[model samples]
Target: MDAITQNLDLFWNGFLRSLTICLWGGVGSLVLGTFIATCRVAPVAPLRTFGTAWVTVIRNCPLSVLLFMFAFGLPEIGINAEYYYFGLAALIIYTSAFVCEGLRAGINSVSAGQAEAARAIGLTFTQTLTQIVLPQAFRTSIPPVGSVIIAMFKNSAVVGAFGVGLDLYSVGESLTSAQGFAALPVLTGVAIGYLMITLPAGVGLGVLERKVAIAR
Candidate 1:
């Protein structure tokens, strides 16, 4: 209790930073991933190839490695930015590949007949997908997308390793080192802090999933 009271600022800032990362990261990845997924399923062979290469390369690369490059290597190439932004960028890029795959799976789940019907009705490929396919695909995709977002929430901790002060892990370490705080208590608070954020998010996503399922 004493330890927690003393470091209230750290814990609060950490929680806000984590929430920021998760929100921005989820949004960024979803948009980019959706585009990539479209490319993967596009009529053009070149677009499909490009999307395949992107997913293959980015998905196969380790998240830590991506973070390291964004945190340390980007500065070397003269793309320096704020530490927080760099960390966010890393999370966005790394998680986008997974998002792409999940969306692609949903896109694939859409029936071929639907696409044919759209075409028969004089819809272009783009119109067919945007209007008829993606809507249904998103419903099927809610579960996997929620899972990806949850994973991204947890993975946001990795930024702390790079000394990003806004991160919960970094804040907890700072308190322990500077204040001689008890590690267990500080860590427990951190765990609970994460739960506070993730639990509601999970519940909300679950509700959305159920609603989408019922609508289907």
Candidate 2:
């Protein structure tokens, strides 16, 4: 217990840093993913192709390779990581592909008849999508989306390899080396941290879904 306590104190700043990385990365992915997914649904053929290609490339690549490329490749071009921007950039790109697929499934699940009905009521396709389709689609996608967000949060641990020194996974690794304990304690902390964020998000999304359903 004392060993764990000592390690906890040693790793506090790292945990806090990791929290920031995960929170921002997950939310950033959600916003950008939603936008790209919307573009894929656009009537324009080029946009659909572009969005599809974007998802394909990122989804097919492993996260570690993508992070390594972003960390090393950008600096060669002068976008240096003196600002920690590279880690965030990598995370956003890595997670966005997943979020895009999740949202695409959600949007597709929205019945075709609903969009047709919305259009019949004098709503433009854009209006119907924004006002009617999205809300319902989001509700339907909440479970899967929440899961993706949690995955993104866990993946944020990968940023430590790019020299984001203070994140949770980094801290855990540091502690394990410094304290010489088994991996159980460090992994336990990481698991708890993930559940702490994701469980509440899942519950809240569930509540929101029920509220929307009731309103309808």
Candidate 3:
């Protein structure tokens, strides 16, 4: 109790930074991933090829490598931004691959007969995808997409490695060293803090999944 009261400000700062990263990263990834998934399944050969290559390459890369690339490598190429934005970009780009795959799997789960029927009605590729496929894909995608968002929220801690001064990992380190708190207690607090974000997200996604569940 005493320790928590003393560290409330640190905890609050960490929480806010983490939330910012997750919020932007989650939205960016979802939008990009959906686009990539659509392209991957597109009728056009070139679009499908490009999407396959992107998912294959990005999905295989280690996330830490991607973050380090954005953090240190970008400035060498004359694309500089605040370290925080670089971290946010890394989270979005890396997580977007997983998001792409999750959505692709959901899109695949959609019945082929439905797509055929849509096409039979003279629907173009975009129309069939948007009007018929993506809605169902999104609903079927809830569990995996939820997992990706939760993973992104936790991954925001990695930004601290690049000297983002106020992220959860940095704040936790500050508490242990500067404030003289023991490591275990500080780490435990950090873990609980992450759970406070992720657990609710999981529960809420579960409810949404149930509500929109596709009839098998």
Candidate 2 vs 3: which has more TM-score = 3
Reference-based lDDT, each prediction:
0.86, 0.77, 0.87
Error of 2 at 76 (Å): 2.1
Write down the TM-score for model 3: 0.90
Clashes of each: 0, 0, 0
Query: Per-prediction TM-score, please?
Result: 0.89, 0.83, 0.90
lDDT: worst 10-residue window of model 3 = 159-168
Off by over 4 Å in 3: 118-130
For residues 28-107, write the lDDT of model 3, one tens digit per residue.
99999888988998899999999999989898998789888998899999999998888888888888889989988888
Residue-wise C-alpha lDDT for candidate 1, range 31-125, written one tens digit per residue:
88888988998899999999999999998898888888887898898998887888888888888888989988888888899899999999997
- Give every collision pair in model 1: none
In model 3, the Cα lDDT at residue 2 comes to: 62
RMSD to native, candidate 1: 2.2
Q: Which pairs of residues collide in model 3?
A: none
Kindly report which residue stretches of model 1 are placed more than 4 angstroms away from their true locations once superposed.
Answer: 117-127, 214-216
